[model samples]
Target: MIRFAVVDDHMIVHDGLQAMASRADDLEFVGAAETPDDALALLEETRPDVLVLDLRLNGESSTELCATVRRRHPDVIVLVFSAYGNTELLTQAIRAGAAGYVLKDTNTGRMPEILRELVRAGSYFDPRIAGSLLLTSISNPSEPVSFSERELAIIRLIARGANNHDIGEALNVSPHTVKFHVSTMFKRHGVHRRAELVRLAMDLQLLD
Candidate 1:
């Protein structure tokens, strides 16, 4: 089961999501919190696979919270569950290390599948907000983005047009692991496709 938690201030959202997860065989609603502090504590207690975070907690953006969760709990995928579709905010969330962003008004029924896709691919963006954010410039162009040695190896293989299976064979890791690394790179550069990722890596001279 995909263990998950929520960090929304609204009681209704908490109750609703708990109900939704209880119905899904593969999803476990591990816990919920109302603020960033409590969310941190809850994460320590539960160590869930995913975190369903609200973009705005008590009328303020939770970009900082997202970043903290990511830095502290790198294995836990943060999925922003927000009502607003502001492109700037979405871009900020992505840059803050949110692995998935889904609008509250969109179909909640697909959330299970979305969460699964996120765990498998390491990223997901709602179709509504994806196009504009894809075109938006990175929030901080001057910020240096570095990759681990393993990630660099995957990038070199991708640049050579190796598929995930080929890359897996070359690296002696599973194809799923290779795809996860590629998708994380896509999120890191704010790009959605492999070609975009490769081009950005080249522009950044990361492939050197």
Candidate 2:
């Protein structure tokens, strides 16, 4: 079973998610919490495979919580399930190590399937927020950036949702090489996260 935990301040959301997970034969509703501290404790106790987290937990920054969880328990994947559609917050969450970002307004019926895909694929993003991310990247009027053909190839792989390991295998390079290139790309684009890099590449039409 794909064991999961929920960290949302709303009891209603928690109950709804719990009920949804309980109905899915492949999913296990591990536990729920209303604050970052409580979520950390619950995660420590349950050691769930995935964490369904809210962007705001009792008015605290859930992005930081995601970073902390990732630092403390790298095995537990974090999926940001929030009502807010702020692209800045989404970017921060991605940078903080959330593997997925799904808006709560999305059909709750699809959450289990999304969570399953996230656990299987290692990354996911809500369609509703994707356009905004692209727009955000495009709106940033930085000096024009250029990339080499190989860098463009890697960016295309990233745009297609390939992780560093997958990119390394596809390019017949070591993961370290892929990391080096990605880091170089990040510095060139003045971005710090994979999601941002992909979005910027899309904005530049580099993936075309």
Candidate 3:
């Protein structure tokens, strides 16, 4: 049987998944959590083979938690179960070491098969984003992302733990402008959080 845990805030998701697992002879619902901290605790306690993660937990992106799970629990396959079909978010999940991305709108009956396929093939992506993902992979996937001087400045400030307001003040720009730049950078870099963007910049030697 495939033992799986979940880290999504919605009780409906938790209850629905549990019901699905109960109906599937090959799947087991090990546990569930509504927060990242609880998710960590549940993982440590259950050590399940798979994790069904939501892209957003309490309005915050859970990609970092995905990375942490992969790092600390290498054997557990992190499967993203999100309502979003945003290509950048999907890219971020892939970069964070997720094994699959399944949309919430997908037929719930197919979930068991999807999980099994993920375990066997080692990766799965929603068909809705497959075309874009393919194009992205075909189009210079190895090329480094380019950032403007202003963006670099904003990134540096972000690395120093500056919020939007602080970065805007430092750069003599409005917070809204700073937000726009940051959001654009997030999409361009396929990262969800400031920390991830800073790390990517450092990896590419963009931040000195």
Among the numbered candidates, top lDDT falls to: 3
Q: Write the per-residue lDDT of candidate 1 for residues 79-148, one digit (tens) a residue.
A: 9997755555676788899999998887768888999999999998998778766555455555434668
Provide the lDDT at 27 for model 2.
Answer: 92
Candidate 2 whole-model C-alpha lDDT, 0 to 1: 0.83
Per-residue C-alpha lDDT of model 3 across residues 70-97, encoded as one tens digit per residue: 9999999999998765566677788999
> Candidate 2 vs. truth: CA RMSD?
15.5
Clashing pairs in 3: none
The 10-residue segment with the lowest total lDDT in model 3: 197-206
How would you encode candidate 2's per-residue C-alpha lDDT over 48-77 as one tens digit per residue?
Answer: 999999887664567778999999999999
lDDT of each: 0.84, 0.83, 0.86
List the RMSD of every prediction in angstroms. Answer: 16.3, 15.5, 6.2
The model with the greater TM-score, 2 or 3, is 3
Number of the predicted model whose TM-score against the real structure is largest: 3
> RMSD of candidate 1 to the true fold?
16.3
Ranking by lDDT: 3, 1, 2
